[model samples]
Target: MGATTVLGLARRAAVGVAGAMGLTWVVRAAWGIPSAMGASVSAIAPVAVASARYRNRQFHNTEPSTQVAPGSAVSLLLSALTRQGVGRPLGAIPLATPEVPERAGALAVTWYGHASVLVEVDGYRILTDPVWSERVSPSPVVGPARLHPAPAPLSELPPVHAIVISHDHYDHLDRETVRELVRSQDAPFVVPIGIGAHLRKWRVPERRIVELDWGASYCLTGTGPGADDLVITCTEARHFSGRGLIRNTTLWASWVIAGPTRRVYFGGDTGYTTAFAAIGATSGPFDLTLLPIGAYDVHWPDVHMNPEEAVRAHADVCGGEPGYGLLVPIHWATFNLAFHGWSEPVQRLVTAAKAAGTTVAVPLPGQRIDVNALSPQVPWWEDVRRQ
Candidate 1:
């Protein structure tokens, strides 16, 4: 072969290799690192089938149909992918606390962004819906990435007595975070009924886990010699759950943590429903309520509450009076799971809470609120979104 012909063939080969390399990167980033489908498979493939079977039964019991239409769902999916109309990026807000304060009977809450909260009450520290993963989706590369970094690393957290999971969604029941929590702390895993299956699959020992159905209560009686038995009850929430493709195989819930002196409620996630009033009537007038306030859209109004509905839920949980104890909002500022402006949730909640005479404390991401002090005043999120 001529020398010129050999050089031309070499150039063509190089171009082909470059093209292949570029394509591979895109594919990897789109799909996540592969996993053993066997674990999530048993629970995954059956979802669409289960959903179809339960469609009629679910609709008959649920509120007037407001489910998102197929076309709308497609539109939303495209918008999220393109990030079109996404507003200015909101930087992480700083939280300054000289030291973590000691609260005996008082409840302390540390917001770890979006549904993850560390509640210290009655000398026992309990963590809830802990999601420290980089993304909320099953894949690490695509889907809704975290809007702000975690307030503190999971390893740096104070010793927890228990880790409670509300359900088995990717955002709420992160496999990675669960493994980390299991390794870092010796806390028992308290979860709703079917969620134990997920934890067990992840290699958590059955001895260190407690599974509860709705209305079931688990008491943490003295683990050692000098421990108090605090009661955590699984309360009903109007929400659905699924990690991969399936939905609602496992139950979702809110928790009522009661002690001898103080009682607090953690509303994991829910839509606008009359059940809140029932909860308040039955086990409330609570000292504090950590409720979700973001990732809401009109498509799934019955599944997630907007800012206005959250205020109402607050009042219902506190007996129609917003002036009760303290209100610290969660489920916002962490993950970009929805299309609304990053700061939209807090902005709307502030106005509604103020008009209703509710006493609210919007703490920085990592800051801890005494629930008694309610210190570090002023709306910091306001400055962030306005920019």
Candidate 2:
């Protein structure tokens, strides 16, 4: 091509790139800015600030957890730049169409990918971290998108007794999902301290919102609805929270869901912490445990747990016998959030579970695992990604 033609082509390419970037910025501004930003700090802070975990206007983990260390940005950048197939699956991931019966079994869990789950504990249904939107970000157009489609639509889900939110991070607390749930379902949203402000900003009714600081509990009753008097307690998680520039303005937590007969422990997202055993002693010996087993890195060990850590946490939650509770891993296989091989999380989890004598159910996204009749540990993820 002639020099003039080449120069013209380059100029057009540059302009196109610039235009794309500008459009992205505009979309983020219009859609990414959370409606909850201006939520009442008083509504969120009073209880949290009073807790021992609260200090300096932020929440802290019982066991000092760190998000990132000094001079780690260079390593993160390097990892991102050099990362090759680490963030994606080699083959298509299989999804399952979960069957939600009219009444949930004694104790069951439907893994909807990542941290989202539908727990059926002693006939009550609790949906945890339901992120049905395409992306888990402030802007639908600009965040970590789902790797696989949700097996079923939100409307398809059966009536849940309650919706439990762990924190205010974009991934765990999605605005659109919450809005739709408000319109469709009558169940109350149970969240950590201060997260109620975000829900209020999103127009969730005050009656349908229940906020609690760590160690607080809500008893639901009626003998016919809302878990028939199931108890949910906000428990400590070793992590930080933020939906925007302000970090720890809200609280992050794990949860203890106790029914009359069975109990479930949800380890939302956390680094390995010393409080696990304490949680077990206070409110555990759970029949089922949903824990994070993905998005772990050597540098940020204090934020997300590895598979091995998850197993250890499971045993702690089970009060010693790791094999006592049914384990279903979460926070992995749904999005490309970290620099690890797509299947590495489960692989490590299976190995660790076996070593720890913990029984784990590796259900495909949307697949439900009845904690009692637990299926054999089939390496389903391996079927897709051949070595």
Candidate 3:
């Protein structure tokens, strides 16, 4: 073979190798970006900046709050390193097969763990902060994975009248789950301010997205016999939000779901705050209150609620008395998100509720209980705690 012919072949081989390398790099970069990390702050800021929470180019809690206090990283790091089984149950978390009644008259709550719940109020179903994905993270291969299987598949869920999203946190708002629901369900999504951007990014239809600022309410049209329809109000919560490094471009909220006969409150992830009393007075007197009872620590004091705080918030929302409504504890027993013992939240909550003369339901994942049947509380976590 001639030397020039050999050189030509070598040049072609080098070009092919370079082309393949370029293609691989491109694929890696694109694959790293997931819909789990939704819209950027800048992309959604115009809508967010209109709210009272939005100021100085970021959203703020009603009161001055610190999400993570200075120099607390040391304790957090030590806890994360030394804690062995603090974050998960000793035994497998129990599951309940939900038999949703054809129609709920007063109210009923079906808890799906980690802040996901289905509230059947006056014959309409409202789903809250549903996380059906395997893990709550931007990466498919990493992040916090579920400790137990979902009580039931999303496809098995009953027809919902509306889906309420409290915030944009990955654990509450999942990418794959949201995409699947958009394709399968006809229910519109009622979300806090600026969360619609994320839904839009996932190709959810504009007509089906209802975004409300704090203190605003949207009435579900054609869902009631009378003029009074199912009204969902965006209420205050002392928390922050972010899908990426930057935080609080979108508002976080607790919610009020008011049916003709039954009223419910969904306390999304939040720190202890006084907004509960105002919520109670303004749009509450809830028949059932669903609140977070885990993933709380002194380090991040102004975000997640402890069990005691959750009980307090529930009373404050339902009226000054815990007897006003049934309290269903959520945001635990599904993922290992904090340094507390797996059963600690339920244990503490039961004690608190009893002291306050409040009725509490500690349902296992997928347990559906009628709010009016709140007596003889079940200690489902005790088996797991012993195991």
Candidate 4:
């Protein structure tokens, strides 16, 4: 009995020391949230407990039934651990050529990174999912850190008429970026329901934030009302959302911007669901479709679409033809959020799109390829990946 008691005491002391060191390391990490580490622990602990309870009680809960594959978990951990070692050349990367001056009256889109894009339609600019943070995690010290620096500072962006957010995921809705935007720009913030709570938490003015549910239409004229003709409507996205602690307490969404001349759809992260076809049947025949093509794996097939599904999604939204309009792939090249090789998503997308006779454009990050311009096949990611 005495021997067992002594062993238990020693084990407890060792565990306590290791835990203290871990806490110190997390608190002192170079990333952003030096002060909020304690708060993060409190926030996430309750959610984890709730998840456990829900899993036990709910019949709808699905757990990973199969055993974890060999080396899969190890690879994920090492990729995350050595994020900085990958060595992305930030300075040598080229900036995208702006097409705004060329396409004065037509709609144009400039992708910042991930789902963040600047869409200029009929002279009115709409910014979507603008994440300017260095990392996309609830905690700055850990989680999927960004591979490359932002192409341009958020402050350097031109005057945007409006800003749109798809969901409340850390990558999709960054708090720091939101605060900076609220202070820097005069544009009204458009987002799905419950995401406004986050903006309010960050002290954004109530009048500047507009929350919309699925199928709700909000009109946007030019600078002044009726200066230009454009209407933006919040549509549904088959995804989930949460920030800090709460999961799916908010909503995820897509947007349909109908210009006088053409209609466009932004499928803000979603799986391959029948909703796309329904959306097409209702407000589509889109001239252009911006789709996600990365951060997908077989494990979460119902959450994010792969490259092939992206092509099919484009066909469902736009007409089922290649030359019908244009398919510009977004949600990649900005951040390394997936387990696959960095360039694999676009390479696979290009091949699948070609087989389907779809006209796809893989623009370099920050580069703009005008739909009206005669596009030349410039495979830029090949050399970058080889490097």
Candidate 5:
């Protein structure tokens, strides 16, 4: 073939490849678009407007909060680019096969990593912030991918009494996980006020979508003896919510799970807030408290709780007593969402909790901890960090 003929064929081949790539991008974008944006403002407005916290068209925190600190945007961007390998474990993050019993125990918790937890209280099981997706983003191909695989498949989870969502953020309220749970479980999704619109968009049955404002409570009755009533309460948290560019159209909250004989607190994600003290006064002195101790940075001080703040929050929710409850750290190990060392949160948490006279359980991903039979603190993450 002549030089011109060969060049012409190469150009045509490049065009064909480019067209195929463009088509693939269109297909992926189309698949994620609906679930990613999640309910229009009109659909969410009717419900959100009625709440006391809803004013001027979006939800607001009791105390003012800045999602990102003033003048920190440039520094945050710089940090994001420069910080390398600090957020990941040096070796494989250990996983455990959750030992779930046929009947839910009196009080136990299985940490599935990065805010996904299964809580068992008085024979009823409640799952919190269950994100089973590989990437906590609208697009599957991009965003903060999981550092480690989910300890167990969604199908492996036993029948839960309820699935509770703290906020509408991609990390906590996942679209794919919700769809899977809707198919596999019959439990209702107990969420904060405006999140029902998102669930509705995802085709979650109306009967199974329970939306509550701060201080609102939902009582669930389970089958069998000692399972008479489990009350799930939406309490306060210092955080913001948004799945897309539009922010706080939905509400964020901590949850109070109170069984007849046992009580647990699931702090989905939050900065330290004074409201925790009020929550403790009304419905706490809890047996266990699962609080976020990760994805925290100085730039966003009013949002995610650092390890020290988490310890204080634990005490505030446990009736103003430092050593009142068993604190288990979440929102750290599975996803590298912040710039801290992989094991730094837990290490700082352990030190802070010790100083506060607080007892804490650092469970491996998917490891079950029975509140009654508490175990000694094992520095498991130290080994992982050193590796």
Candidate 6:
């Protein structure tokens, strides 16, 4: 064939490939676009505007907080480029098969990595911030992917009395996860005020969504013994919320799960805030506390807690007694959301907890721990970090 004829064929092939790629991008974007942005502002506004925290058309923290530190954006971008492997584990992050009993324990917790946890209090099970999605972003094609597989499939979870959410962030409030739960479990989604809007948009039954402002509590009644007295409270947290560009249309919060004889605190995601003291005073002296200890950075100190801050926050939530409860660290060792060393959070957390005389359980993802039964500390992450 002549050079011009050969060139024409190559040009046609390139155009065909480009067209196919462009079509794939368009299809993926379309599939994700509807639910990715969550409920529209108007859909969320009515419930949000009535809250005391809502002012100037958005929710605000009791104490002032800047999501990002002023003048640090450029430095943060530069750091992101340079700190590539720091946030990743050197080897496989070990996973555990969760030992979920047929009946919920008096006080137990199953850590499923990141912010997803199953808390059992007085025989009632509560699942918090259950994100089974591989990526914690709006689009599946782009975002921080999970470093470790979810410890267990959502279908394997024992029937929970309630599913609680912390905020409307993609990581915590996953669309696909929610839809799956709706099909598999009949438990209600007890969430912060405006999050119900997103749930509603996703076609969650209104009867199944119980939205509350800070300090509000929902008493969930179940059929079996020790189930009627389970109370899930929406507590305060210093965190921002948004699934899209418009922020804080939904309120973010920590949670208190109080049963007949046991209490558990789920700190969905938050920075250290004084509100914890008030929460402890009114609702705590908890048996167990799940607090975030990852994805924290100096550039956004007001929203995410560091290891030491998590220790302090645990103390604050446990009525100012550092050793009052079992501290189980969440929001770490799953996704690389910040530029810290992969295992730095837990290592620092251990040091801080020991100094504070706090009892902590660092369980492998999917491991279930009975708070009543104490175990020796295991340095599992060390092996992964050393690799």
Q: Would you list the rank order by TM-score, best first?
A: 6, 5, 2, 3, 1, 4
lDDT of 3 by residue, 51-79 (tens): 87788878888888887878898887888
lDDT of 4: 0.72
- Write down the lDDT of every candidate, Cα atoms only: 0.75, 0.86, 0.85, 0.72, 0.91, 0.91
Model 5 TM-score (2 dp): 0.96
lDDT of 6: 0.91
TM-scores of the candidates are 0.86, 0.91, 0.90, 0.78, 0.96, 0.97
Runs in model 4 lying further than 4 Å from the true structure: 1-25, 28-105, 223-226
- Model 2: per-residue Cα lDDT over 48-158, one tens digit each: 776777788888777766788667998988997888448788788999889888788898889898899999888888999998988877765777888899889899888
lDDT of 6 at 40: 91
Alpha-carbon shift of residue 175 in model 5 (angstroms): 1.0
What digit string (tens of lDDT, one per residue) describes model 5 on residues 191-234?
Answer: 99999999999999999999999989999976665448889999
Query: Is candidate 1 or 3 superior in TM-score?
Result: 3
lDDT of 1 by residue, 250-269 (tens): 66788999876788889898
Badly placed stretches (over 4 Å) of model 2 are 1-25, 36-43, 225-228
Best by lDDT: 5
Span of ten consecutive residues with least summed lDDT in model 6: 220-229
Candidate 1 lDDT for residue 310: 85
Off by over 4 Å in 3: 1-32, 223-228
Candidate 4 per-residue lDDT, tens place, 333-386, comes to 667665666777889999999888888877766766556673697987777766
